[model samples]
Target chain A: MKSAFTRNRPLATAVTALVGLPLLLAGCGASSGSAGSENVTEISVMDYYNNEPDKSFIGDALNSCAAEAGVTLKRETVPGKSLISKVLQQSSSKTLPDVLMLDNPDLQQIAATGALAPLSDFKVSTEDFAPGVLSAGTYKDKVYGLAPTVNTIALFYNKDILAKAGVTPPATWDELEAAAAKLTEGDQYGLAFNANPTYEGTWQFLPLMWSNGGDEKNINTPETTQALQLWTDLVKDGSVSSSALNWTQADVNDQFLAGKAAMMVNGPWQIPALSKQPSLQYGVVKIPVREAGQTAVAPLGGEVWTVPQTGNKARQAKAAEIVSCLNSDKNQMSMAKARNTIPSKTSLAETFAKENPKLATFTELVKTARARTGQLGDGWPAQATKIYTAIQAALTGSASPGDALKQAQGQ
Target chain B: MSLAADLSPSKAQSRQHGPAVDQAPLVPRRRNRHRKERLFQWLFLVPAVVYMALFFGYPVVKNVIMSFQDYTTATFFTGEAPWVGVQNYVTVLSSSLFSTSLLNTALFTIGSILGQFVIGLALAIFFQRKFPLNGILRSLLLLPWLLPLIVSSAVWRWILDKDSGALNRFLGDLNIIETGVPWLTSTSLALIAVVGVNIWIGIPFNLTILYGGLQEIPDELYEAGSLDGATGWKAFRYITWPMLKPVVSVVLVLGVVYTLKVLDIILGLTNGGPANSTQTIATQSYALSFQEFKFGEGAALGNVLVIISLVFAVLYLRASRRAVDE
Candidate 1:
């Protein structure tokens, strides 16, 4: 046995060397191949519009933008949840796509990594963009990305159910609670909003938290607790289903569409699906504030286009042109109309709201919408996790709203 | 000439058919042939060794190295992960969630293994009897194992949904309760619900292995036990159990190891939610790395899990060895 072991040592070393050689060579090859010629033709783009109508709608927009930029398009669409991880992987491999689309909240984190080149470097104009949109795409005051269209959560009420219950569309917390209590009956929940243990839950809770004067930087304060209390009371009173603790925003939309929920807090992205039910008349309103006079501040939701540092200067420049074209007023208007989103430009949004009155509330909400990462920057995900954790704790009856927030903040 | 005489019949026949070798070099020729034979044996093992090193060894070593570094999202782009020694382990072990996750991992593994094994063994023994359509029934039992875990979890999610799930609807019809049971929603019940789904997924695997073990038990032992007034319960105790001990140890060890790293079912069903009632070390590690981009902490937790699995594996080796000795 000893002799046999000694005999195999050389073979083992040979195997290790053989296995490692390709990996080392491959790394060198990847780095060297990225610095290509100046006459770039097919610029690659990556985004997370992997699902339906939005996929085709965004595809057409990108193809047209590529045409305008005098380059053929090579586009890759991933599922929304996987986009960030994919970006990190590609960044490490030095194969990051020329044009990258990130969820606005994620722009700061990616920008912090220096993987994204600031759009200003390519002479892309940020003029006429909404403050919230600009803030979402900005890191350390340098604009790294831009969203052509943006969206925010709002109160989506089922018209027939609200009419049947004789409850008005709520505009304040008091009215909302009263209206929800009145509408809840038998098998139907009065309101549906996700409080799941995910970032989506934090996004849904932001309208209430921000409008109530809550700050993510210091969530243990009274204002955030009050917002959490509102969520807790609704679940406790059975106005909202206890199952909201597990429901995603998509699930809340489903509950509303099935008439199991009289109202839901969701984004306008649900409009296409809701429109399919022609008989189901639904109206959108800004998410209610704590009091009558306070403004409703919803968190901005959209995908921002940016140029990634792919080591090819010409391609990066061409990619920035496509991003600028996508955010052009004409393209923004067309994309917003097709995608049921609010245009990022303040003037275009006003004209868009005038043309499509159905999106007026969303347009109005966008004016005062806040970017989640505006205050926390790359640190936003940690705070977002804490917020959702607190929501789950309070809603699950494990702790009081204040205690849950305090405990989460302490973590 | 003497070496040729010592050769096996086949080798000697081949040598006779080939060109004749010089008598003076016979000893050296034999030693050269022996060395070539040894090299050929090692060459045959190359693929398996390379595969194990590349897949299992590389990832485990990489995770260990990452655990000592301040690896994060920035590290991906910058390629600079400063070594932090034991700081990651210290943080991960000291966190409030660590104890909860440890306790939850223990409960999840014990509950799943106990439920799956007992149920599996019973089904395996029951199927030992002669019954019509027995083969088809046993094959049907393997369906749960055949389905992808994600697919199974998705189906179970619908079945266990609070308001409109099939389980609630069925229970409602039977007047089990007035309201829907919040199977996947309640903090108190979410863990159990996740465990139940895991158990269902694991049953087929346990049953298939235990059933094969049971088939290997000689019927003659049972026949002799019956003569000694040991029929049903007595026969199983005296004949089947002692013989099935080795397989039982294997099944339990494998089940525990698999259950310790369960992520997908818990993720798909609840995402370690309802206030993290279902959060195990595996899911928490996943959240740390992918969700929070805290790769260092995630690798630390993952290493802790690997140590636990290694402990079980050691015990399994000892137990199997004891079985062999017996």
Candidate 2:
């Protein structure tokens, strides 16, 4: 009996390995559709719209576009931060999805890698889009992606608190400081903004920096030093919370909603959530410029849809069709209305603003907003890192504004 | 044990002396049977060996190869990572942030281990006493370690917030101090606060392991020591310390290895921020690879960290071998 059992065990194990290894190896092959499948049935798509309102809104648009293009959509979503990492991993494995969504600023970086198919090759029209938004999705003068709607940071104030404190929305640097100080009372800070050690921090600082004539290429100049000093003075005077060094844009909105901050610098994405708060009355305006008459050149915020190079020509062309369909004026207007952002097409901006009165301020702000990658292209990441590092050093008192800028700029 | 004995004819010869014919026919059959048994036993180990080879060995080999190449984001799409021959190592070592990250790594590991060990040992000894609801209370102490590290970090972020945090609010309510301490926002205080939270997370792990060791030391030793006038502090000095040496070495060595690679806690809390005061080698390597897309330089830094850990692991194995021999 024992001999029978022992003999059967080895034979059983050998049989299992014989069947399993081949199956596992077969499962590990390339993931995307074949290059020349004649019947082009379904196209896989991926994006970072993992959060609510966006998750469903983007899903609805993608489904509608896939129907228009005569194909089915296979969808994948990841958190906003992990999208690039996922793309790189997929690209290396040759398993990239047909359609990919990239945050606008990240488009140049990925496009420079030659992993994306230029939309011009597919004859997708890139006309009539906002100049800055189009530039963000372009690399080497070839359009790689296009955003349906775009956004930028602006000043959001608690209307009730500002009314009770008798302070109008500040329009320039000096007025901002005075109003912030006068409103500071009890547990609330007068103003709040993100200075966290990330690209978001660099994004928030851009309006202040660009409005004062500071450029990313020349961060150590007097123009930049004055911008850094403005933030430093606020931290020093205690009008802004010292905790801004650790706060993300979401945390700033949290403080604003909690009555712990009278005003915050944020974007229009917070409008839906702000309106959800029944008792919370808020108003929006352009980010205060360094001086009156200066343009408030906020950093542009949005995501762009692109066709990844999956080596499937038919599928690639179809993916570009879906991309264009997603960016159509009709789809752009509807998505903007649903998501509370401004349409990327300049012609649609007037109608979008009139229809969504609450977001009129943002519609005007998006026209003059600057693309982070416009000057540096793929090189913007390293510069953005230095900008935030300088901001943190100055805010924490580890270095003075000029010294911090010099050290961070390595000049 | 039987397999080893069966393989050695010398061991069998010393056990029996018999006539040639009595052993001949049986010897050949017995040898065939033993060989079959041996092959069967090895079949059980094959799956685990293959798993470790695929998951662990492949990544280590890939990382070593990548460290020698000029790997970047472009390499992912083009598959054109050229051999650079130590250029990545030079770049990583030459950077000014290298020394700062190295020092921070050492400070963080030492601070977390020391605080965790001392507090954990004290808790273990206290819990050894016979008390009401002792088992339930001791088990509940593991809640912090049981929670995911990210959850603990998020909660701690709120608790340590300078203005509206629970810690500062409590302090203010008690009139302990007028100004709230900038726990996470200040460069000087951020490292200390990070270490404090890490210690809190680590204490439960150390407590459970050390408490198991304490349980294994028979009570008769303490009873005999008390009779010999070795009571209380002397009992702990002469008996507990000597008996607990093996567990102590294990806890400390494992603590060092684990703490040296801690990333999520620091990333969640401050993201190595407030002027990079809390940046460690592990976090710096992550920033290089994931954030900056300099995969080659990141792999070089990771290999440096692995070399440090390997030295400790080798010393630990040698010490443990000697302990077993004694």
Candidate 3:
């Protein structure tokens, strides 16, 4: 056996060399790509509007804006959830699109990475934009992104169901609880809202938490506990189904459309789907506050367009031009009208609300809507995780609201 | 065929071809021909070895290195991961949720493997009997295995939904239960329900592999056992069990390894939620890396899982070796 192995030593050596050759080659290879050309005729744009109407609406707006700026557009739309992962991959490969759209809350996190150029770098004005929307796009006092339109969650109730139950639109937490209980019937709950273990859950809870004077920076306070207690009481009262722990915002909307839920807390994005059900008469109102006089403070929900640092001066300037033009007064109104969202600029709010009365509540809410990252900045992601974790723990009855908050914060 | 002949290739060749091809002047040519034959034999194995190295070995090594470094969202852009020297491991091991996750993983794997093996073995043995349409029925049993895990998870999610689930509806119709059972919503029951769904998904794979193993054991052993007053339980213990030990170990080890890293089913069903009753190490690792963006801690936890799998693999290999030797 020893003699045979000695005889095959040369063959073994050759095989070993062959196996190592590819690994060495793989290590030496560098993945790089050149930026869009200086004399750019067409600039690449990336956004998360892969769904139907928003896809076409954003496409038309981009085409019009590109024409206004004297350039053609190359568009790439990904699913809403995967937009951040795609941006990270593109950022690392130095292949970030010239123009990119980010969910408002994520803008601060991405901007902190220095992958986005400040709008002021290309002489784009941030003046007259809603304070909340501007705060969402700003990092360290520099505005890195701008939005044409924005949205926020609100109380959407079935008009037919409310009339049948002899219940009015709830204006306070007590009224909401009573109304939800009154509407509860066989196979149907009085209320539906997402409290799933995701950022969306945290987003939905912001209205209650902010209205009750809860702050994300210090989540385990009395105000936050009271907000969580409201959710727990609803679920405990059997007005909100135990399955709200698993439902997404879309799932909540489905429950409402099916008449399994008399009311749902959702955003204007559900309007198109709601319109598809012609017989379902739904009316929109602000999410209930903890008290009658308290203002309903919903978290702002929108996508902001920005120019990424693509290492090409001419293309960056042109990308900025398209970004600015997409947010111009005329384009903002048109895009907001096309999509079921409110204009981000305060100047355009009155006109947009007058034009699209269905979105008036959202428009009014947008004025007081707070950016999720307003306090935490880049730290918002961690806080959001804690918020959702606590919500899940409290709703599941595994921990009290206070204990859940403590556990969620890793104390 | 002899060891001496193999060591001395020229002697074997001369004996085979009548000593004519072993000429002294043509010795270099003969050596070149032998080397070419060995190279061709090696060429067949090179592709498989290269694939394993690239796909499996590289990732394992990369994960270990990442576990020791502070790999985060910034690392993807800056390409700078500061080495933290086991701090990630410390954090993972010391976290309060670690114990809960470790216990959950053990229960999930053991529960799934035990349920699948017992039911699968029973079906495999039952299918061994000759019957009409037996072949067709056995082939159809593999359909569950063929379906993607995510599809199974989604179907199970609807079936186990609290208010309007089919399971509750069926039970309610029979007056077996008044209200719906909170299968995925309650902390105490979610883990068991998840394990039950996983067992259903795993049954087909175990049954097919065990059935193949059973067929390899000749009928003569059973006949011999029956002659010696061994039948049914006695026959299986004295004959089938000993012969099927190797295959059983393989099934169990593979099942444990696969179960240890299950992510999608848990994510789709409970998302490691309802107060984290279903939070296993694999799902928690995913949450850390993707949800919390803490890749280093995720890698640390992943390495822990790999070590656990390696332990089971080593024990099974040793047991199999002893079984072969005996």
Candidate 4:
């Protein structure tokens, strides 16, 4: 946990991989003679990753890895949640793909249930991966997944809206409140925030909690209560709409594009969607602090590839190989560039900026991203929903935030 | 169940006539119904029964078990669920919200059924007159019912919007009232608005069914009444009412069952909101199960709703049988 706050020195290994990505990819092609009887085995991977251009960018890297390893790669696209459900369903029927992409697969409980195959068993080295990335996919100190990209949350704002309001993006809690209030007018809201009354409603809340030095599952504490208080204050002051309760991030995005909202706290996944609205000019900013003098610390969330235990050892081995190759620097770089995703390796952040300069601003913000506060466990799922929904009720004037926080903490 | 069956020829009769009817000795007894046939019967039923057992039955049973145990959908997805017995249900009951939600659901059901039945019966009677444009108007009447629930709910939500709602704007333009009422946003008014919308959607169904029932009543009886100097309201009450009784009873009971179980309408309408005042049992049950993953508590809620519907169904059947006998 502490290693996360510390650098942990991944710079040297990442730089090496970045320089070698192209050369290693080149060596993948035109193998013959002494290459032995091993032929390139092509496997398809399906994920909700990026649009066509970014998909092709990542596709190119996957192809390069296949060539280098005498293996071929094919890809399929699906929404992340749908893809994960498909994989889980396939486990019962033994109809799994060679490789899969999942977000917050939370394989620890799955691994504990003997679903995921341990990575150590496959002889894969984990030294190059980020601490949290590997740890999130591990169970009882055994790796179950290899994440190609690291996705984090950040504050997204309309540059035109801010400029017209004669305000810069707020750096601190008080400043955020003042700026948001100033930006508010009839039919134009200051902040488009998540008001979804669900456990997962913690997206905006978590960052606020962290900035206040609070953790999840302990929401009744002073720091957590302060975080909840921030939202309650906004709602009560009419800076935020009470009707935003139980809304998805897409709902917030819709409001922003319609020119009804000035600023909203969303995520990296929303960048492409925002970019698609050519008429709307916006930029990504680090989340504003809700604490006395702290910087915003938005939590990171992304997908990981994991192999599961099954009757067919041959298929399982092949799947493991596919996971390993897909995690290569070439594919990671392509994904980073194409999808605006931060690869688990810090080096790809530079590649992403070089490939797509527009995303450089967001890539820079990745340095200070924090993981969500709470153990990724089974107990947290429904409890989180109850807590968030109650928070919504509190914010919407049905209950007080203090009472809501108390209920959540009790749960 | 026994009354509803389409009875096949009796096996006992065939057995009794077997000695005299059978010609082939080598074929033996009951050639058409062999042990293999019995095995095949089990086999045919297996796939459908197994499918239900796994997907529906198991989940229902599991849900009941889970309501007793503190379970979450996310935790269930990860596959290691620790049991905390009856805590979730006790908590749900003790929360002070469930009782009010249950009352809301009952009120909604009663209000919706009464409005839909009365209005629908009126439409059915009007359409029975065979007017010049009856066919066109009958088809047009189904517009609300034809639209999907969620889509219509969203449209209604906009129309009920406090600021930009079309209904409010039109009412203001017409000066129907001094000011607009917060149709959906108001805690006290949301439930009434939802029930009103639901009744509107339900009218076509009642009209169609009652219209069909009106057809089955002979014109001869009405003609005889007219010849005997029986006039409009009196003749209609004595002659038309008796025939329509069966159909009205069915509609009333079915409406009770359906309206009681209404969730999507409530979910799409106000999402049981403004506060707990508009909340319903069906919505709470779904929210408890899928959204909260408290399957057990959800199941308990569901079971209560199911029992409510089942009681109405049984009552309808009993009344129908008594009506037939009388």
- Scored by TM-score, the top model is 2
Query: What tens digits encode model 2's per-residue C-alpha lDDT throughout B117-232?
Result: 99999999999999999999988999998999999999999999999999999998999979999999999899999999999999999999999989989999999999999998
Model 4 Cα lDDT, one tens digit per residue, B1-326: 43122112223333444444444645635565454334443443444454566577887787667666645433433554577776666777676667888799889989999999989988888888867998999999989888999888888877875545688889889999555566875556778899999998899889888899888989899898989987688766888788898888988898898888888887877666655557788888887765544666777777777777889999899877866775
Docking verdict class for candidate 4: incorrect
RMSD of each: 5.4, 3.5, 4.9, 14.2
TM-score of chain A of each: 0.93, 0.96, 0.92, 0.80
Off by over 4 Å in 1: A1-32, B1-25, B323-326
In angstroms, what RMSD does candidate 1 have relative to the true structure?
5.4
The true-versus-predicted C-alpha distance at residue B72 of model 2, in Å, is: 1.5
Candidate 2 regions exceeding 4 Å error are A7-11, A14-19, A33-35, B1-45
Alpha-carbon runs more than 4 Å astray in model 3: A1-37, B1-50, B319-326
Per-residue alpha-carbon lDDT of model 3 for A102-132, expressed as tens digits? 9888888788777899989899989899899
lDDT of 4 by residue, A1-411 (tens): 433322222333334545665675577453312222234355556566556765676567666655665666667777644554565555544444556655653455445555668777787656666555666676666777777777766667889989988999887778878988998898788987876544346666777887778766567777877777888888677777655663567767777878877988777667777878898988777777765467666666777787766544554566677678767787777676566677776656676767766666556655555544226454555656555755666775666777777765665
- Decide which is better by DockQ, 1 or 2: 2
Worst 10 residues of 2 chain A by lDDT: A2-11
Score candidate 1 by lDDT: 0.90
What's the residue-level lDDT of B271 in candidate 4? 69
CAPRI class of candidate 3:
acceptable
Ranking, TM-score, top scorer first: 2, 1, 3, 4
Cα lDDT for residue A119, candidate 4: 72
Model 4 C-alpha RMSD vs. true structure (Å) is: 14.2
